[model samples]
Target: MVTTWFKKFMGKRLFDRYYKFEKMLPVFAIGDRFCVTHAEPKTHYSEKDIVNALVNREIIFNLTWTDNGQAEIGSVVRYLYDFFPDNQEARMFGGHRPIPISQNYLSRAGGKYIQIHNPSWYNIVYVRDMKDFLIYRDIFSILPLAERLAKKEEI
Candidate 1:
């Protein structure tokens, strides 16, 4: 009963956030300097062009939302072209699942699940059907747990 109202109230607002990239605050390490990288060199864009593109791209899509949405080159994100070949983690990724959240997570989380933040690794998205996120919403979220259990050598 209460859950229905909550969803009704939020409605599109929940999905709207997915479009706002700049609003997504940058997560920084204690002493980490913001950096960006460009993994692939296929793009005709020069160093400066890539950096500007990254920021521009950041505004429309959620950079941290998906593996591809994120810049593969951490350097492009943190250092820009000033240190391109030197920095490589910022490989700019370009991919998207245009399906709505409901259809998108149908395989893993249906529409009700949300991927929670993880301390040690990437986000492990969950859906309402599994009931996993309900009991262990925070402490044992999928992020590191899934990776840790999946393989002893992956990480």
Candidate 2:
């Protein structure tokens, strides 16, 4: 089953990160492979703030519909833009698009992620999120993050 394969992948991928658990929990795969933190979300950030958040940042996104089971529950793409970047322009998976995530969402991205309202768009050339993606310090170490997660908790 794909479930077994995903667990294997996540285990190997997260091995160097977190402390081991007595019993391994089940990990879920949806949207894409990204980090999920415990930061707080901001439902009311000023327009100026968001604009500044995504300036000069190139994003990388492997989008799929929320229509499927993977679509709705797992919405935001949670990756460390600076998970291992050594330059100003971070390695993003997608361009900046307007995201309206709940504060719960922001916290998961460590308040470092931007929610994409309509993530179904294919080619996001010259978008807003590309500009202000500077949360370098917020980028978590995989090992530490893994230490925080023994198994996939859910979306």
Candidate 3:
């Protein structure tokens, strides 16, 4: 398996250290009106499922590694609603798919999901209060760096 190969390549000590660090990270975080995750859930997860996944190594590995682009926007919205019912304005923020630099962040299901993953895009979203937020993108620096890199030949 790729994971087995990766672990071997990394060696036991390095892999174990990285694994320990990764285990410390939260699978998801819930704020007053928003939820943040590295990637979307493939299906609606119950509260119990989320809790179990936090402690189950295999579940955490699958959630963190394999399930990218498997979750539909509708499913993600439902998951958000199910988990954060009190906040009707609840939004899910995640990144695994790279959208266009121009597009920056992709909003779906009436702005309930926001996907921001492009480093080249230099997109930053600021959450202020529970309902308001601001998005800032730096075009000035990004464009020139992109242009210079694009013109360079491979060594």
Candidate 4:
């Protein structure tokens, strides 16, 4: 019915390498798994400003494509150099390339993510999101206290 590619798209090898790279960082608690406040699309923050946002700092390293679904390597490249000519790292590592995202990954990655224009390229997960995946075992968490506080403050 299905092929191995679909099954392993985000599994095993990728997860192993990703986990090995990330395990070097200090561990965080479950409450630290999500952004305390919402993050704007990368389109909103400048290079310096995004770094200052305290949470979701990975957005600073990503390409922010505002145009809908024009996901091609050439198109992404043009947008990158035009928007961030001064950036040297983006020219070298294809790390920050932003492609059109599916609704599915958004539900998983939560705060911020980047898709590769090419399906073969791995979808870029934000550092915190990757942390949520490896640590919390789920990106979304149940925050009853925060929910109650919000409801009480609304009245």
Candidate with top TM-score is 3
Q: Candidate 4's residue-wise lDDT over 14-56, tens digit each?
A: 7677767754432211122222112113343343543344455
Backbone clash tally (model 4): 0
Clashes of each: 26, 28, 0, 0
Please report the candidate that would top lDDT against the real structure: 3
lDDT of each: 0.33, 0.29, 0.66, 0.34
Model 3 lDDT per residue over 50-127, tens place? 777866765565445534456655776777777777777778777666767777787755677677777676544556
Better of 3 and 4 by lDDT: 3
- The 10-residue segment of model 4 with minimum total lDDT is 28-37
Span of 10 residues, lowest total lDDT, candidate 2: 59-68
Q: Could you tell me the lDDT of residue 30 within candidate 1? A: 13
- When 1 and 2 are scored with TM-score, the better candidate is 1
Minimum summed lDDT over a 10-residue window in model 3 is located at 134-143
RMSD values, in order shown = 14.6, 17.5, 6.0, 19.0
- Could you tell me the lDDT of residue 53 within candidate 2? 35
Candidate 3 Cα lDDT to native: 0.66
Give the worst 10-residue stretch by lDDT in candidate 1. Answer: 104-113
- Residue 92 in model 2: lDDT: 27
Model 4, residue 25: distance off in Å is: 25
Superposed model 3: Cα runs more than 4 Å off: 1-11, 55-69, 121-124, 136-155
